[model samples]
Target: MSERATPVKPTEEQEREQSRETERPSDGGADAAGPGPNADGATATEPVTTGAEAVVRALENAGVEYAFGVQGGAIMPVYDALFDSEIYHVTMAHEQGAAHAADAYGVVAGDPGVCLATSGPGATNLVTGIADADMDSDPVLALTGQVPTAFVGNDAFQETDTTGVTTPITKDNTFSSDPDRVGSDVSEAFALAREGRPGPTLVDLPKDVTNAVTDREPDEPRVPDTYHVQEEADPEIVEAAARRIEEAKKPAMLLGGGVIKGNASDVCREFAIEHEIPVITTMPGIGSFSEDHELSLEMAGMHGTGYANMAITHCDTLIAIGTRFDDRLTGGIETFAPDAEVIHVDIDPAEISKNIHADYPLVGDAATVVEQLREAVETSPKAKKWRAQCQQWKSDYSMAYEVPEDEPVQPQFVVEALDEATSDRAVVTTGVGQHQMWACQYWTFTEPRTWVSSHGLGTMGYGLPAAIGARLAADDDQEVVCIDGDGSFLMTIQELSVAVREDLDITVAVLNNEYIGMVRQWQDAFFEGRHSASDYHWMPEFDKLAEAFGAKGFRIDDYDEVADTIEAALAYDGPSVIDVHIDPQANVYPMVPSGGDNGQFALTEDQL
Candidate 1:
């Protein structure tokens, strides 16, 4: 039997008070831009610029370097303002692509990425991407056009409730009602997106508001006074947590996406290595710690490494940093970490015990709290034998697959070949599916901010657009590659045009299986082999489609063609596509059925 420790919880009254305090800013609203010249050097007396100009000026003041969007009627004025600005804007083929591109930019650039969309259909198109950002806690700012204030309720041609539609998915949203305050409203949204527990935020711009003339400038980006974040954990809690770590017979580190977002990856790596603690990364936390290190157990949860899941199940002290104990990672909560006392660290307090219970809840910035533990702990855990056991598990369940000369190409082989072809500075973006799992399982990620994908929302068609944004955000020397499934690649294939027009150097490899592979796999396992709408046999030749879009195209059908095709595609100066045909019946393994124990993951179909 495992011993459990109860965590302290705040009373209902105190919780209610804290909720009210966050909503009511101590300073009534954002500060006025003052009486002097705006960013364009135009004074209030001049009143020479439209509210649209102020909107673009606010972005300039926020140090926005790039924006992604699609042009439409209601948003044309803002686009006109953008035409004269220094910020580089990429006109995407679809609004969804625009939002995904901006989101990927945020993931790599470590700043709040910006996106724009017009009213109605345009606004709705961004919902998927916005929700993806919200679920993953990526910092992004979305500017959406709204119909004229007069026509809001009357249902004007392109009118929709942009703010209302996005309220649930955004960290915060505002309707720019006043011309003078519109710029400040955008500034506030940008600040809120990046300040505390980063997530996407939105600003809705009505036609009348942006069309009106306004010389008032925007306040510098700043969060509201009432929005305070705890920077350090309580000293007593840190000391206690440190003592627990010191006394641990088997300790393990679980790092999540927040480590990279909070700039805590370096500190996490140092702490884990110095103490010889085994490290397990969540799917989103793939690149937070180098997988090649001796103490690393790689990823944990459903499709995670066997050793990583073993460590989570058996460790005596679980140091979980920045993770929210997502269901996919925790499996059955009762079975998860049954033998361990969880030390949960996160910037957001609400996430501490919302999922699995936390024995030591260190609520603060990820890096700051880790530093506190570092200072408090005087001795490392005595886990030499435990470390040996973890290494043994790693050896027992190695990620290896066979490729015969007579059979079809294996997707895993293709992923490993791609990894061998790219430089270490390469950035990878993937759409959600079996291909996503193959890439995650095979690629050796060694740096922070290198792996980008749709984790929480699992949005398909994210790869191509994300590659476009990552290409723009990354250093010139860094390569951007999109690994996608056939079903996923077709959803937003129009984005290839944007890549070609911009002369972006990105390689796209579509692992073609002619089916909704993940769904098909589930049907085979649990649904009694009922493929039902999962077979996508009538798919277009993606390579030919790429050529039609004016990009270099290649095809790889057999094992001999793998390396050369990838090499040629990467050698292309502009955007390139490689359609790699793989075994249609192939399925990803090391999966735990939904809500199954992580320690009891299956390695093959029969086993499952």
Candidate 2:
């Protein structure tokens, strides 16, 4: 039997303190305690500490290592406090870059990454990153400095409703007006950001509140009362799911990012191997299962491997673990796995039937549920023929691309070359577009958390900063590479300066096609080849741009120079950019048309 441990109940005194904290105003104000001795043996009348100090102390108590952001006028107080704290602050070139760096930091570090921004445009600039974190379910804490509390409603300079603006994008948002509650507010923000279905959380700190003095001691980090303790799936449900699997002729498993979030990759792999189940993953789920495994069907969806999509399309029973049936994975809802009976396991009950209906909805953490399912399930010979058939499909429809003999380089070849050079040991990050799809398809990931990208939001300008953050969080010798498209790289090109200043050894590989490649492909297929506003006209020279940012740059126009340039860029001690010109007319093949089923993929040029 799986251990069913419950959360420890709070003591009476602790309960009373929590109640008092809850009743405190959203606007910053004094706590219920007067100027007396506090629980930590410190007198309330003891030398008051600034709210900024208290915020730093709270983050320290919560075990945050780095804070990523650009220092601004309104947020200078926190920066001042950071000077005295143990936390390292990474100064990014832009607020959006900072937010993305924080998000990626959280992903690689396995903790909530913190970002600080000022009010008004500074806070607004973080919206894209915040939304990206929210969509991808990454835990990130965004701290925004606001105008003085007194001037909040007066339309003061740099004033904005930071909490109001971020409410929809964050798991929770708070406006702190009282210096006394800064510690508690920040602590809660960290907890909420990580608790159940992790996501971004925002805390709005008014400048006046940050400057205000407080006597409150920083509390030890504790699980928020609202957080639900994860439990193993019910025995009966696990048994029933096992029975369904035992009875099915063609059983398959679908993995997602949740498997990584729950740290269940090993157990998931064990279950798949034991049952001889073929595994397919979503975009963010790329590394959840080892691509080299025999049963691994790299990724299944639009732009997925032909064999993987075929497996998902033909499988009779699908055991979906921690994956939400998003539109990208499910080409068209009506035709997706039409004959399969899904046994869905997710931590969030709301996600169980939110998209595709689940025949067995087992609500628990992926690690716990997968373990229970493994224990309940018995080896069945029924799936032997099915596994053999899937293996044949994998051999027959393996991913393939043709390279022209001419000079123009193909983006797929670049990715394949990087894969060969890196040997799958480097942490790979990418911006959205054709480059992202190519990275997902070509790069073989053998470990979890090695592949990072903006999966759900599909945000461009994510690669550079995310690679910076990933490099900082990774081991000293781990190579970090960002494969970005020309259009995507330009979106956050300023981050090149941040990489140079930090002396991070990261390689940025730009597939420069001189056009919005993905958009151009769609236009070519559906818009009668009318390429309007898609071409770049060769505006900015990327190698020069990298050099201008104090980083080494190399341009590869000929196919002969691709391997050496990539190797040289990787060998550089500091940041470097390798701009390889790809065929402008090339397109990502094996594409399922919008609203089309997985079976409706256009594999060859004639099909398109």
Candidate 3:
């Protein structure tokens, strides 16, 4: 079994039958290809199986070690086939959890993650995760079971047009009608998910198709011949961009998620260091650059570091790699990097000038294009004074929060304490909210794939499920930590049961403020302090809740309890939750309003 596969034991009867078959069977069949006489029959020259078995074989051929999903009627055929296969299936608490888990697995493992679900609500439940992957460019392959082809358009029980619903979100989608072609459809979907600009793909497997018998085997996963990605940018354009960088008095390098996805972190890091340029990353690009380095400006955006924003405001040359320039990162495009000439590098041609206009667009693989620039550059930029200025800005606006003796526990304190306790390589996952920002700001990321979270879609219940995926993908030495908020945790907390069942070692720290913290903060800043529906006063005690789910639970109410609770929770063998009650009034600092200039950020509401 693969290391990632956790074998689910078979029943006594099933084991006995398997032993009997092993003891009696000795007729090995010769390798050949032909239509099967029957589902179970095999010839000396040909081996025959059902379509469902072929699906499992295709996954095995593709080296799939793990899969995440739920059991259902339409998908029962595939699940039954999986029972005999070596692939390990993580039965998630919900289909949505399954989708997010697969997504995070892809993010961490650098391979396309697989998920499965049945028609109707099960298929619908996966929509959010699919959309999340679509927006963030995470590679995920979703397999959804549909009603039998005969019943597909008849509105039969549990019937759903899954392909129709997911077409807009997936990079490609297929509805399998022929048993002979079903396995290939799945392979194609899996291939398309990780090709070029990575994104989600889906294959709708109808019950009849999966149930039908077939001898045809799926080919190795491959995209159509027509599909192509430009691995190397135009050599002339790379030369021009290098010239701009060499001539720049104030130059900065911006790394995005693509730097990590395309496996270009090392080259990008080397290029930046060789040229002595300050590096800034967007939220999704957190781990692409080492924040511990002197040239690092951390993340740049609405809640980015003050110095990072300042560098963008005044830099004469901005070499942005792998980012789509989301509005959150490029606040008020008219004001963002106004003085700089932009050199944008992205694998997708559509993203080059889609948002912020790229003065020098270099469209190709991130690593390849960066290597091109590295070879083409003749002289490094002279930005000694500019680098010093960024250092000074870092000192001027430090990421410090006051945890007074008389005040409630600060969320920042909890974040830092957790970071201090875990190794630097520990994988961090989060849901959308104040806690997410705190994790992004306080936790120092120095490695790619170390940071996993819902970025583009901002899904609330992403943390715990993501932890499950990251834990499976991560090495045994690396710890999985989830920094979630009360609201976000509550959304997907049910997955805690799955973690406990699997005996996964992960610690979830819920920055419990008894409110939809980010929404309440926004209400405070933008809505005249009206609480409205943002308050979450009736929240459950997450520490006690974890215990109810048969896992260790700890709570922190005072500064004295913070360290001990986190230690105790991390020490526990299985899933653990530290419900650290944070100060309700605390808010994310260095804030920028929608479309505001990145340079003019407020440290507090009064400043706003």
Total clashing pairs for each candidate: 0, 3, 0
> lDDT per residue, candidate 1, 1-608, as tens digits?
01111011113545424422332112221111222344677542343278888888889789887788987888877876775554557778999999999999999999898999999999999999999999999999999988888889898998889899999999999999898999889999999999879999999999889999887888889998899999899889899999999999999999999999999999999999889999999998989999889998999988888889999999999999999889989999999999999999999999998998999999999999999999888999999999999999999888888888889999999999999999887999999999999888899899988999999999999999999989878876788899999999999999999887766788999999999999999999999999999999999998998999999999999999999899999988888999999999889988988899999999999888
RMSD of 2: 9.1
C-alpha lDDT (0 to 100) for residue 88 of candidate 1 = 59
- Give the worst 10-residue stretch by lDDT in candidate 1: 1-10
Runs of candidate 1 with Cα error greater than 4 angstroms are 1-48
Best by TM-score: 3
lDDT of 3: 0.88
The residue pairs found clashing in candidate 3 are none
CA-lDDT, candidates in order: 0.88, 0.84, 0.88
Task: Give RMSD to native, each candidate.
Answer: 11.1, 9.1, 5.7
Candidate 2 residue 19 C-alpha distance from true site, Å? 42
lDDT of 2 at 371: 88
Instruction: Give stretches of model 3 more than 4 Å off.
Output: 1-48
Best-to-worst ranking by lDDT: 1, 3, 2
**Residue range 81-199, candidate 2, lDDT tens digits:** 76554455777889999999999888877789899999899999999999999999999999998988888889999888888888888988899878998878998889888877789
